[model samples]
Target: MPDIKDPLFQPYSLGSLQLPNRVVMPPMTRSRASQPGDVPNALMAEYYAQRASAGLIVSEGTWISPLGKGYAWTPGIHTPAQVAGWRQVTEAVHAACGRIYAQLWHVGRLSHTSLLGGQAPVSSSAIQAEGVNVFVAENDGTPGFVQASRPRALDKAEIRAIVDEYRQASRNAVAAGFDGVELHAANGYLANQFIDSNANDRTDEYGGSLENRLRFLDEVARALVEGVGDASRVGIRLAPLTTLNGCADADPETTYLAAAKLLGEIGVGYLHIAEADWDDAPLMPVAFKERLRTAFPGTLIYAGHYTAERAREAVARGWADLIGFGRPFVANPDLPERLRIGAPLNEHDRATLFGGEARGLIDYPALEAAEA
Candidate 1:
């Protein structure tokens, strides 16, 4: 084959690290973490190591505390066992010469009482996400999902504690041997719930206007930086125009643009935008993307139904610094290599997308193995 000079293969610099390609493995919840303690294990380690060829690996969203969990079998970073469990995962990825970032997450109101010790979910407001649901373990040891419970608005004290939890999680991530950490502020999670006006009805300092709504996000970013002691190792994911998990704002463009500028000023390493991924999902306007490119001075990464051709075009236009592949990385461990060589990709099996063993996680055949 002739030499492939794709921009996706070109090296790029993100903060203090240099990337070999612009392909990123974005955070995807497989719901396969070890049960009982929601700890990372050798299975998760092998799964990530198999896809270490990506320019960057953003680990699945990890709950920072018991209250942060919204799903069954997802990992956490708060406890000693959980930290040690992640140590093995980080070691495995590093052994393969891969760079990985831990995505710190708190699901907030998008949770069930069953998942939260029968306690009401907490959010910026008392409103429950109308149609949102969370995965939980059933009596038979099988995974099942339940609708989110009505949430109580968090007071200032509780909000402060949550910020501290984020800081602690960042410290734990470093101790666990991660290269960096990404704040899960997207997809109507806690941070996004705070950002979206409809979900946040507080009249206090944390609510009312745009600046107030952005306060939580700012505090979390600052806390992560303080914990990691370096803004270069910190990244954040946002969903500006997404209504996923029932998060919607009247003026999404303005709300997110201000946030982009604020994050840029904070000197974060990168800004990841998770565009609506479902089929018939609202398309992210080009004008908004252009504005985002200008507003956020750090490296920009975008994910959502991207193809090789579309990714190439995105980079060619200076729109994205990296293209995150969620499902592609799931089915193609050696996705960057396959893209480079124009090899056929393995189709993802939706049946095994979540809560499975190695059948769909680490067993995807690489091109070399497939040909052999």
Candidate 2:
């Protein structure tokens, strides 16, 4: 038999951590946490533990502070209870021979006061982010997604506070028995708010030049590094050039490359990038991908609609160090096993994506079930 060991299934080193393979399970939002605030629970622990076969599991975008959450039912790391809850999750994943990292996040202006315990969501500027908030369907039969939330302009002090929140959140992640943390800089969130000139119109030093715009990202990176040890332990997620979801940067490639170079200089552990479109949309422009890959010398993980074959090509061609599977992992808990043998993937049910019980969350039958 020909040797089946490929880069995707081969062990590699990311910073100081050694992983079982180059295949990664990107952070996915499973809104199964407790209400009021999305505190972690036993359900979440079991969910992650079941999928521990991946090389690395970057946990879902966990809110760093109360105002950091845009949607309801997402987990947070600001409170002691939340940290304790995450400890259970990490313990379970560890027992399953999995390595996990908490992806720290802040939604910025993506949220409304109505959702943040009646406190307006804060952002770099007062501009409203143009997008719909995803929420779990209520008892009503209609599909419901909350409208764009009102945002309050943040002052210099508030901006500093935001950075501090991330730092503390990183600390919480470390205390929770996790291996590391990945800053949620993607998907039009806080750091994205600063990077997007449309949302950032401040007259202060934190605005105008690209350097000023990326200051928040750099500061957060520094804080995260301090909270989580070296830069190798702190990764960052970037939705570079995502046109969907109302995210349109003036010059995405230029902006993201500049940011990538900065991250490289800062010595981040790895960069988790959500590729252009991420769906049945456009593939990344060859010119842009080359620039980012060149600037980012460390680990590169690509997400959004990454097929097993494409993942192998990416790693082989040096386009990406690892490929992140989002929906596939959601529908097929043992996605790695399926990909290993070219097995069929279970289609994901959109209705049960957010919050639900074992029905769609954990009930997806494995290959063994199918064989039986």
Candidate 3:
């Protein structure tokens, strides 16, 4: 057994999986998938395999369909080539004795016509996310982000079809050999847009009241549950207080608390809360944390700017079962081991954070190599 005194090192049961430690490597979009098809490749597989030391590895946001894609070069699980590519990633991680889950994503209004083949992005409503920009490959062979375009509100039939897309993506993920799946409902993406009243203005059954607003999440969760055939093998991410990608709910506390309750009712294996990682980002309140603990009956994971000390405190206080390290893990593949030995961490290069080659991806030296 791991040292109980070090709450961060102690093992915890996350749904049906028995994690070796409380360290989690949360999803961070590197936007490095192979171009032309946004398919996972050997380079992506190698990157994930190197970081397989985490107790749980949540793969970056992967689009569920072409319509769901918002950024250039981000992987998708909706196609045959993409599924095969992800299979390589999963196999590599598994070979390294790591368990990985694919995060299902749909960006909604956080998209650009340049990236969408000139098609307007789809969302819960026709509202545009003012001042949001999405990264796209420039015609000059350089990467650049352009302003997000106004989105067309998805019709009822289209909404239902998107749920099917999520279901198919879950099936593809399982077939691709992922240990499980995580629905990317956080960070002001598609699901977040539907949940945020400011982003969603509709008089239909899927809009207006809080219950109506939650309808999209409910349907998507249900479809994933049905596809995966086990609630214990599924997770959903939520970010209540974030105003990212032009999404801000009228009453975040109440809206997120209710969302937690609904997700609990749906019986997902775990709930991943994404805290804003920016320095000036507001911290999630203690009261909100307590309420969330009561609202969800499954394992709870917290992400965003968490240090070792804070992660330990959260685990000791029984609030978070696991703590996720994003940028930290980007530069430290063996993060758990480094934390265990209290080694100085390597800094991640911000310039190579987004779309990049191996220079910043799999080239980050491990602690032993750095010492050598």
Superposed model 1: Cα runs more than 4 Å off:
1-4
Model 3: colliding residue pairs: none
| Per-residue lDDT of candidate 3, residues 246-278 (tens digit) | 899999999988988998999999999999889
Per-residue alpha-carbon lDDT of candidate 1 for residues 1-372, written as tens digits (9 for 90 to 100): 223568888887877787888999999999888878888999999999988888999999999998998988899999999999999999999999889999999999988888889898899999988878788888788877678899999999999999999999999999999999999999999999999999998999999999999999999999999999899899999998889999999999999999999999998999999999999999998889999999998899999999999999999899898999889898899999999878999998888877978898889999989999
Better of 1 and 2 by lDDT: 1
lDDT of 2: 0.83
Question: Mind sharing the TM-score for model 3?
Answer: 0.99
Candidate 2 on 18-53: residue-level lDDT in tens? 887877888888777875557898888988988898
- Candidates 1 and 2, the one with greater TM-score: 1
Ranking by lDDT: 1, 3, 2
Task: Give the whole-model CA lDDT for all candidates, comma-separated.
Answer: 0.92, 0.83, 0.92
Ranking by TM-score: 3, 1, 2
